[model samples]
Target: MSNGEMEERIIDHLRRNGKDTALKICKALAVSRSVANKHLYDLEKSKRVKKNDGTPPIWDLMETPDDPRPVLKTDTVEKVSEIVRTGGKTGLKAHEIARDHGLTRKTVNKHLHSLMDKGEVLKTDSNQWTSTGHQDSQASGDVTVSDSVLSKCFDIIGKLGKGAYGCVYKAQHKYDGKMYAVKKVKLTGDADAEVKALAKLEHTNIVRYITCWPSSQDWESCQDTSDQSDSSIVFKGSYTETSDYDSPGMESLSISTESESPAKPSQKHRKESVDPSNPSTTYLFIQMEFCERGTLTTWIRNEKKEQRTIIEIDQIFHEIVSGVEYIHSQNLIHRDLKPDNILFGAEGKVKIGDFGLAATLTNPNGAAIYRTKGRGTRSYMSPEQELHSNYGAKTDIFPLGLIWFEMLWELSTVSEKAYLWPDLRIQKCPEGFCVKYPTEHKFIIMMLSPTPHVRPCATTIKENLDRFFSMNHMLCQKTI
Candidate 1:
């Protein structure tokens, strides 16, 4: 690309990506810092872009109008002004600017708002950008990727769904173009919780954690849940950085998490959660493996519609157990486990995901007594977790039973679909669905045992699964 083309590309990138640093620009556009700087240096003279000075200077593209107005003599304002004027009474839509100007609808909308606020322009009743005198109107994809920081690393394909902490997007890596899932989170300001836990994990059944970078600066901050004061935490971060680091991923990124209180609980629900005092320096991003088949919730619901024989049901169950077992082995408790958290990987394999709610287990008496302020989804939560009391690893088992119940109900005959969420104790037991695999059914029941203490361990749950598979080996192997 010629230097002029490069400048246009820079403007185009800034428009689409909301805002990003020059380093990210160089990385995404595959240009050197010097090259990007040279063009940016020239563009600034034309008033088409502005660079903010900071740790890593940020570049913002201004909306420029074609016919430069006396007031908006600068390239940006003139460019935007022309676009609006061209629409006349019809008025230009934000997306229209996006299409012709290689700018994002968001940037156009923001510019329009600013212009309207200053009486430089107006939004018609038609909800379009126009001169302040233009008459009336009205007014959006579900692309599941960040429109800001993560956009530098991945191109958002579509949104999977909203998670507890943030929205999950199915994104494609910028360089490799391989697909991945990116969970854009607020993380109460820092990513210390999720990142530290995930970094320690390396397992097949667990969703892999790819490298992540925080939003170099807060372009858009997420609205997070209100704080609740309750003392319950597990992994308080005892480890230190090791030399066994992966490649120094981001040249401009010096991301390191620090805690003054090493003795602090790994997880805690505070009453007055402080906002990120230095929010400009924070915005956590989580990138992980994308399960092509989507969440187990979607999968199960689809099965209800198709009534297709889901042969991999047993193996899927086995994988779920294996994943939880692995998590438990790491002294981490996935406080939240539901059909939604269990996603399908390549082939018919299942991997556990969404550790935003995971808490490290501190064995006080050969058991993890979680003092968390109510964790887990209400439906899948164990009786103890629901009560918000101190619990242990067994707390996780309670939900596995619920998960198994859900899958079994999904796999059962069409007639058995009516009460998928019925009391598991009497959950279609008479119809013999649960009776089909007695050992498996028995383990599920034990997992849901009212007293968490008696609930089977993840290890025991897997053992039961293995035994059930053994007894039905011939039938199972042929089914999936």
Candidate 2:
């Protein structure tokens, strides 16, 4: 086929598939891999497509000749203005801006970087840029969080993390004299579902909801009325039935109930409590215990600490499984469990956070509910999850295996040196280097088994690890 014909076919493939890897296009179009890639590059250069920089490049079509080119000049200026206006506080990455504005990622990145070079935008972090040099008033204008809003809380601290929903901040409660991690989620469709799912959970190993606060600001600063209706729907559910409020949002008050305290209310009563009815505003303030040690990912990546030993691994894994088992018992599936969501508390207690994608396995009538989104990190997701097939508790097991492997190996499986046990066994080993532990290795293998049904249940996994630890103790005694 001619180069033009090959390019057309490649574009068509990306359009049909939404996203297609070069290998897939090559195989489907009967073209060489290199030829397919060259065509993809040309298509991307022509601004007719884009590629997702994952493990493999997944090409996506941008626009066809007949399609109207989206007007991004207005969005670009508005986003920059928001950044400049927010005193560099509310900046979003190019990709995020692109997704929000329905524009091409390439176009967004190009304009954003240009703005950065011109001193109109400042790079806040990798891929995150904000506006600088302007005073708080010049940047925010009337859109600023009112002093009344600020006074209601003790002090708003720095950001903890960002997600699809909203940014989480570490804040101090002056009246209570307590530190709380406050998750400020923008009211959106799925956000309400997340709040409902979280309300059902009362595990010590999970993060507590202090409260939820809703905002009346436009979803994005674009002032585009078309998307405003969609935004209101997303934020409305969290504030229904509150008669005292006269705003569009509400704050949910949450406190960590994990501590053994007679001062705290019982979990049963807390679950049944409801806010007063209101129409103008609905907000929730979720009060959760602050995890000082940060996320498990941060802990693992920080080179300052000594490598985690086998015992530490056992302890951490036990905590994780116990928490997961509790979540399972509550009939909820944490669809997005990962190292980033696992956190360590003041006393080194491990707890699972970020339940935005969690789902209740059973409905109000106790019938099973199946989730369709298949939400999770790709590398840690089970094959069933990756394929968007039916999943259950077994889905969590896959990430458990990957986490264990990383803890033991001190490297990700995606690394070149991370090989299967069988392959490693065939090679000669130096002295003092121990072979992969039979029980632990077997456990990982079982968890990573291709079939979800064959994967060990959470209880079975916990029991197996307990037995393994017991056996290790016996072996140590013999050596002594």
Best by lDDT: 1
Candidate 2 residue runs with Cα over 4 Å from true position: 1-151, 217-285, 303-306, 365-368, 412-434, 473-480
> For candidate 1, what's the RMSD?
24.9
Model 2 root mean square deviation, Cα atoms: 16.1
What local lDDT does model 1 show for residue 348? 55
lDDT of 1 by residue, 5-89 (tens): 6776676566545567888788767899999888988988877788787778888876456633233233476477667866777
Residue 275 CA displacement from its true place in model 1, Å: 12
Among these predicted structures, which one has the highest TM-score?
2
Report the C-alpha lDDT of model 2 over 1-480, residue by residue, as the tens digit: 567656655654554345768897787767789998898899888787888879797888775555343746744555644644464466666555656667665455556544543335665524366765432322333222322232355455333444333445455676887767766543433455567766777777777655554433211122135533333112111222112211112221222222232122112221111123312222234456777666676556653225665667778888888888888888877766666678778878887886766767676898544344334555456666655423677888777776665566654433433344323322222222345555677677677777878888788888888888777767767877
Q: In model 2, what lDDT does residue 404 have? A: 66
Which window of ten consecutive residues has the lowest lDDT sum in model 1?
246-255
